[model samples]
Target: MFRFLTAWIRSLSIRRIPMKIIVIGATGRVGSTVVSKLAARPDIEVYAGARHPEKVPAADNVTPFHIDLHDTKDDIKESLPEAGKLIFTAGSGGKDLLQVDLNGAVKIMKAAEEKGILRFVMLSSKGSLTPDLFSGKNPSPLANYLIAKYYADEWLMNNTHLQYTILQPTALVDKPGSGKVSLGNYTTNETSIENVAEVLIGLAEHNSSVGEIIEMSTGNEPIPEAINHLS
Candidate 1:
């Protein structure tokens, strides 16, 4: 009986933790930060695809690859897989957010569909909902970009089978992370890129379906405390 108990315990402990995830735009400002945090975990299988794969931090577990968003679906398929989580943190590196954010993402989504990858997470900016209405043109300079993001977010929302979480951050700033955050519509008076990086890692580890569009702002939320608010 003791042997039986030991065997059962071992079985439970040995359950494989799934780590086959593709971190798109892994070389970007936020993506690189996320890469650093996940690299330490032995259980995670991270594919850090970037435009410049060589730029990724050297880590044993991270598999870096060249993933240019400008590539066609066929080209993208070669770099992507059929079933796994995909976190898109890549931007066009220009205001051409329309081509990079919307079109590039759509191409990836198409590849995922062919491969049957349904789980997804995205980093989006706030207030992108206006273009879907009668105004054929986007509202602001970045409106075209916003509309593109807004529509993509909407498609994910409509699809129930796919588990998705959309994080809409305020204007991204470069500062150290204090860790506390206020999940509200108001943009933070100040927001550090480090804090944003921390939050993205938190999202990856925690699994919750609180699928509301929460806006993050700069505040005095402590680091350990902000880490806890991921749910």
Candidate 2:
């Protein structure tokens, strides 16, 4: 009876542990930050999904998993069964923008839906909803980026039942985060990548940030308060 009771207690404790959150594109600037921040939380575990798993940080709560955007959805899903929340921070790296940013993103969303994981957060750019926002020359890099983002953002909203938050920051800067931001209509032209990472993690766990496409930048309001206003 004592051994049986001890086994039952152990099972209960294991069941109480929170699910892991996977950060896709974990080698990137923003994605690495997400892995680090989420790893610091005692309640959360992080899987750093990167094209080269060796490049990911070595943290006890963070596990490196290899995931190429070109890989099949079944392969990606099989590699990340423990992931309950999926955050997409992958960029085209100046090559295969259509495949990586659009098609791959859509495939990931479908995998999430099939797996019954409802939480997803995408790191997107501002002006993704408007082609006219580009003022530069034809065949612009920025224009191409926006076009890919536009389709992915649209697909997530139109198809998936996932609790999704798409953050469209005007421009990303490498400066330290202020932990304050303005959500809905960009009030500032640039935002720190650190702040964007924080907001992504916040959206993964917080109920207030769900179901919103926030145009974010550094601002007066605190991150939590700004996200709350969105819902």
Please, what are the lDDT tens digits per residue for candidate 2 over residues 1-231? 999999999999887576678898898989988888887887788888888999987887888988887889897667665667889999876588888999889888888788877799999998887777654465445877888888999999988898898989868999999999988877899999999998888888776777888888889899888767766
Candidate 1: tens digits of C-alpha lDDT, residues 75-115: 99888853367777888755666677877877777776667
Segments of candidate 1 deviating more than 4 angstroms: 1-18, 81-83, 130-141, 159-161, 222-231
Clashes of each: 3, 0
TM-scores across all candidates?
A: 0.80, 0.87
- TM-score for candidate 1, please give it: 0.80
Q: Where is the poorest 10-residue window by lDDT in model 1?
A: 130-139
Which of the numbered candidates is closest to the native, going by highest TM-score? 2
